[model samples]
Target: MLQLHPEQIAQRLDQLTELSVELGRGAAAGMLHGGDITPLLERIVLVAKDMTGADGGTLYRPSADGRSLEFHISINDSLGLRQGASAGVAIGVPGVALWQDDGAPNLGSVAAYAAHRRVSVNIDDVYQSGDFNFSGMRAFDGHYGYRSTSFLTVPMSDHEGELIGVLQLINAQDRETGLVKAFSATDQRFIEALAAQAAVALTNQLLLRQLEQLLESLVNLINIGIDEKSPYTGRHCQFVPELTMMLADAVHATTHGPMADFQLSENERKQLWLAGLLHDCGKITTPVHVVDKATKLETIYDRIHLVDTRFEVLLRDAEIAALKAQLASPAQADEITLALREQQALLREERDFLRHANIGGEGMSPADQERVRHIAQRRWTGPDGAERDFLDANELENLTIRFGTLTDAERKIINNHISVSIRMLEALPWPKHLQKVPEYAGGHHERMDGKGYPRGLTREQMSVPARLMAIADIFEALTACDRPYKKGKSLSESLRILGHFSLNGHIDPDLFDVFIRSKVYLAFAHKHMQPDQVDAVDEAAIPGYVP
Candidate 1:
């Protein structure tokens, strides 16, 4: 038997202790960062080989069905073989079966035996031992012209004593003569400790990833509900996040801007992405009719058809009066008929004018609004046999809406969605990395001058991601042609309005500048905007913009 001197034994003990410390530190750091566990697995095998002075090692994780041990990584310095270390090359070796077809544990393979028994198996030499099969190793050696010798297989288990993987090392070399030797008790103990640490780290990483995936699925579920509620808003929910990321990437890449110092880590980017997806989630609570108010006089249905019926009544009444007057005086029949024609022409002209006004276009001139009031003064007999104004109070209120289709009350209801979103998002218990989601999602509608909705937060109160979302949300709305009320504007038109907003303290000026200089709008336009809406833009012509 080969033995180490007292001094050599002491030096080996110190090295094993250091390796254990490094393994524990690495596992702890990986758990804290929530990164991939592949590196940790690779490190475990490396440490095992170092502890035993082994010339080769392989790590095996159980297959999904628990019926086989799949080769995850294999390293052989003597053979100059490195199969897996995150380089993604296929291992090319088949899995070691854990169970035979007879439904019995297959203890012939040393890795499988360790995994099934949940114990370490140390061999002085594999070619000389008959306890387990080494035929595969013999064949491998014959094919590669190498020797098959000492073997040490250890099972990795978590705290609950469930086997997670198996670590197998081969050909332990003597420190003095560089000859193959058996792994000692010290080597086995250190490897067993590392195996335990590795198992726990892998479990924690898998759990963390599962939780993150669950959160993302819930966010998507909310968006799907919103989509089923309204197709227009569903598109908005999808496009805004995409545009937000686009703008954020632009700001992150800019080196000369006011936001040059702004940077996003991987986790921070993920948080912002989730925030963008959920920004308009509160719209789900909004009344569908109010959100989809297509015309000025639209409710459950368009009330303009009722106005059309009223005009028809007036036309019939005018004809009946002409006929009665003709019957009363035969000589004045021609004059009465001519008067009837003129009256019918005037009524038709007014009716056409009202039809045009009902569209609720960009702006309503004062003269047009006054004309609607004048038309409302005409008397009409109701079905109840009482004379009433041509337009009801509600109809007058709706038709007189100066801007878009929504009235002030409906606008308030629409704006309340942001508040609802804030409440919903803030109710969730979030991790430290994602605690900013609510702030980023909720601050999209807030203004730079503190005149915005819900909280009316000023620019300084918001994060850069929040400001980026603001630009994204507004730009997507302006260029979107899917909305029921307004046609999408061209690139030049949207930029002009956005520039005005930048100067008017409606949005952050620095982000807006990045938005323009980076041409983020052009990228969004090409992807989501209509062909006609992607018009040429003159940077100098845009208002409130220096460029």
Candidate 2:
């Protein structure tokens, strides 16, 4: 046996204390940079193992039961051991420590003490423990080929003084004799300090994880609300983000004159994607009835239906006149009844023609135009004998070729949602990375030409990323299968229209062509469009549009 002066022993203990303190400080600094538990645990184990000069060590955290501690981190001489090979705080050699409660036990007497105390115990010499009486002790030594005779154990507790777990060290080397020896009193003290630091680090990490989970759950709830509001727009709020990311990736791949300077880093790209996802979050404020309007006669004052009902009343009046004339028994009465019936039928026919004409979106033909004027000019009388006008000049003009169900004011209100979106996003104190969300999300409806609402920003004013989103929004709406008002256009038809927009300077022509040529739209269609609802565009229909 080697002997050392008391002063030398004291100096070694101080050095061990300093090392433990340094490790704790390092872990504390790391925790401030967004604490992640796994990495923190790994670092704690490596540093502790190196300082103690142990063959190996494992850190155990208390299970929910608090009676048993599960391994949280394990470091061997070189690498980690398989997790389940040694588990259960009371079923292995490691179990002795958790079963003994009193003052620390040496290797020679730990087994007997562990059985007696039912709390943590450490063993320094397995061969000399003749009085120790643990049934699993011999089996544990045999299984791991035990040759060393040293151990250290410490309890882990939170700031509240609640026991969190235990730290165990095995087979520490004797500095002078170069032989395995039982863990010194200093080793035990050092471990106790390290365990305290670990408890604080772990607590912080758990709290952060809980907060992240809460944020994810909230975002999902918002998405569910969006899905529930409109039957025809299922998952639009979710799909927009995915499409935006794909387009952003494409832009990164092919750099052009202006696009070359506007490259987004990986983090910036992620922010753009989040912006797209939350772009329509303001749509929650819009009325679902307006979004799903199927006919021009949609408002509370649906004038077209009023016109049809007036025509029905005219028909009934004609019938009454005919019966009266028949009862007169005069030859002049028969001519008057026939003329009234013919006039009533003509008015009914004219009303029907106008109703169908308002729904026509295929660009009104010459005959359709003339029928509109004739219907507007016709008049009928009410039940009170008050003269009723079916259509005023202004109403007639608007009803002639209905482009959409909403009135101009209603359309403006809906378009104004982009500004609403911007305001809502800006109100939130978003991370700096996501600060551009308001701009990118609010500009999805803007056109390259100075014709879009809210701001009417032209090509130079809008970001390339914003332009990509605009294209995506229009393309998705045109090909959407679930909208109530119109059947989804075929892909070829949609592409032809997109091409027209490109020529008219509403969209970027080069980007549109590139998207088609790369078949990027095909990928997006496959992912978002219904299986039977998607098809390839015919290049011929897209005149001069080469992709």
Backbone clashes per model, in order? 0, 10
Please provide TM-scores, in order, for all candidate models, with all chains considered together.
0.89, 0.74
lDDT per residue (tens digit) for residues 64-105 in model 1: 999899999999989888887675778998899999999999
- Per-candidate Cα lDDT values, in order, are 0.87, 0.65
lDDT of candidate 1 at residue 312, scale 0 to 100: 97
> Please, what are the lDDT tens digits per residue for candidate 2 over residues 196-228?
667676665565456545645766666667678
Which runs in model 2 stand beyond 4 Å of their true positions? 1-40, 60-72, 78-140, 147-168, 174-178, 181-205, 252-266, 300-306, 332-341, 358-378, 381-385, 391-401, 449-451, 457-464, 508-514, 538-546
How much does candidate 2 score in TM-score? 0.74
Global CA lDDT of candidate 1, please? 0.87
Report how far residue 296 has shifted in candidate 1, in Å: 1.6
Clashes by residue pair, model 1: none
